[model samples]
Target: MKTETKIMASILIFIAILLAGAVFFLSGDQKTMSQGEGNQLTYKIDYSNGQKIGSDSAKIKLVEFSDFQCPACKGFEPFLKQALTDYKNDILFVYKHFPLPQHLNAKTAANMAEYAATEGKFWQMHDKLFETQEQWSALKDPTEFFIKLGKEIGLDETKSREAIEKSLYNNLISRHKDEGINLEVSATPTVFLNGVKLKLQKFSDLTQEIQKQL
Candidate 1:
């Protein structure tokens, strides 16, 4: 009977520790990152390279490290997009590249988006890529397909080919990927809000956090 009581007390203490951690999470710890569900980490944030939208002076910076060929990134795209639209006036939304090696076309996709950025069409190309990701994601080579996408979004096809062929934005994409690694991003669509990594499984998870900051 005494042994049972001690075990029960230990379990209660463990539960209390978990509750305290939840409270800390609610307190808005800004220096830590969660790599998916259970892994928590702390890493520095850098945005010297990315396509940006929204308020330049906003207190909240919502940053996404995404891979073009990543389906999980695609799945989360809508929620992230809605959050950006909803919080456009209240936060700075920046999209960075984190193309995985397995996704053959991912790096090319990033280059094409950056190519489009030069023509002031980054977001347009971005939408085009994700919208048609399934079509070109599996190709043995996707550069020509990317040029087709470029033309679809009003980018000059010949210039797009030149950009792809020359790999003009590869350096920029490389820098973005390196930055994501530095931030300890282990998966696609890793997002950080005001320096705190968010576990966003639904729209509410994001909006509620944004509201907390606002």
Candidate 2:
């Protein structure tokens, strides 16, 4: 009788282990599905959509999803500018918007930059926003500040103001964010060399990566 009881206890333990594993696997699958909402994840580069500079036919594409209000992005600007200047013929640099929710002025600044793009002056506004990020980023309403920046970059004040008020570039900005999300970009200054996402610790890291592809 005692031997029979031991056998039954072992059988119950084995069954419990199997049930636990099944639960774990199902929960793991559910977590993954819930995170991405059961949709197919797409990760592809749109070569022409973002603000681009350098040789159109260049073999290396350096794409950066950045926010103007991010200090780290600002800190990385000089290095990127130097790189752009240094590799004008070899590298095609594309700038996409990825304004984090924590930064209040980032999206507005991105809109102004996009508006400037329509006037054939995106890079100019891009520089202006990063240059004055500290000042305008703190204002209660950065609309006037951004318009002022637009003016500094030769964007028409009335048109810039209207665009900001109307949020004309919202769709484009959202699309950029969506693309970043698909690529699992959770931080500003997420850069991709060609299609492979880069883990950038510094400008030297970027230099080495670019050299490898060149």
Candidate 3:
């Protein structure tokens, strides 16, 4: 009888040890997951080279990785503009190039914007590109329209054409795309607010987050 009792106690002790080990492992895994979430929330975003739309010293910085030819990006543009207007005093908005492979005119548009940047008219060109995205996106070759838009924005036709034809800003566009890739950006309108990636369901979602930061 004593022997059986000792054996039962031994079994209970073994089960307890197994349960304790599992709890320890699960707790360790939870800790690792928490750390990963913290890291993602605090990931650093680089905005040194993109087009800026607001004061650089603003407390809230909103960065967007965008493709000019993307329909969704086109849809998001108005809300983005409104955000800029609403938070004009408190936000620094930056647009970074992330032209998707499927969008034929996206890279060209990015190049044109970069050329416009050289002429100090990037924001104007940015608005023109999105405002007229449908007209140029369907064209087999949009260079002529790009030049026309450039002229509208007061950029020198010769310099703009030269920049577009020779892809003078291809390297810069590629750099921005690379930066977006490094940040795991796979879509046209990936947005980051103050270095944290935001999954925006509505315009108010963005504004609420901005208000929190402000």
Off by over 4 Å in 1: 1-43
> Which lDDT values do the candidates have, in the order given?
0.82, 0.84, 0.86
Which numbered prediction scores highest in lDDT against the true structure? 3
CA error at residue 182 for candidate 1, angstroms: 1.0
> What is the Cα-based TM-score of model 1?
0.78
lDDT of 3 by residue, 15-122 (tens): 999999999986764522333244654446766789987788889999999999999998998888778889899988889999999999899999999998877888
Over the stretch 71-163, how does candidate 1's per-residue lDDT look in tens digits? Answer: 988888887788788877888988999998889889888888888999999999988899999999889889888988887878898889888
Model 3 residue runs over 4 Å out of place are 1-40
Residues 101-210, candidate 2, lDDT per residue (tens digit)?
99988888888889999999998998888888889888878998888878776789999988898989999999988878867789988888776777777865777778
User: Model 1: which ten-residue window has the lowest total lDDT?
Assistant: 29-38
Q: How far does residue 67 in candidate 3 sit from its true spot (Å)? A: 0.6
Q: How badly does each model clash, as a count of residue pairs? A: 0, 0, 0
- lDDT, model 1, position 40: 47
lDDT of candidate model 2 versus the reference: 0.84
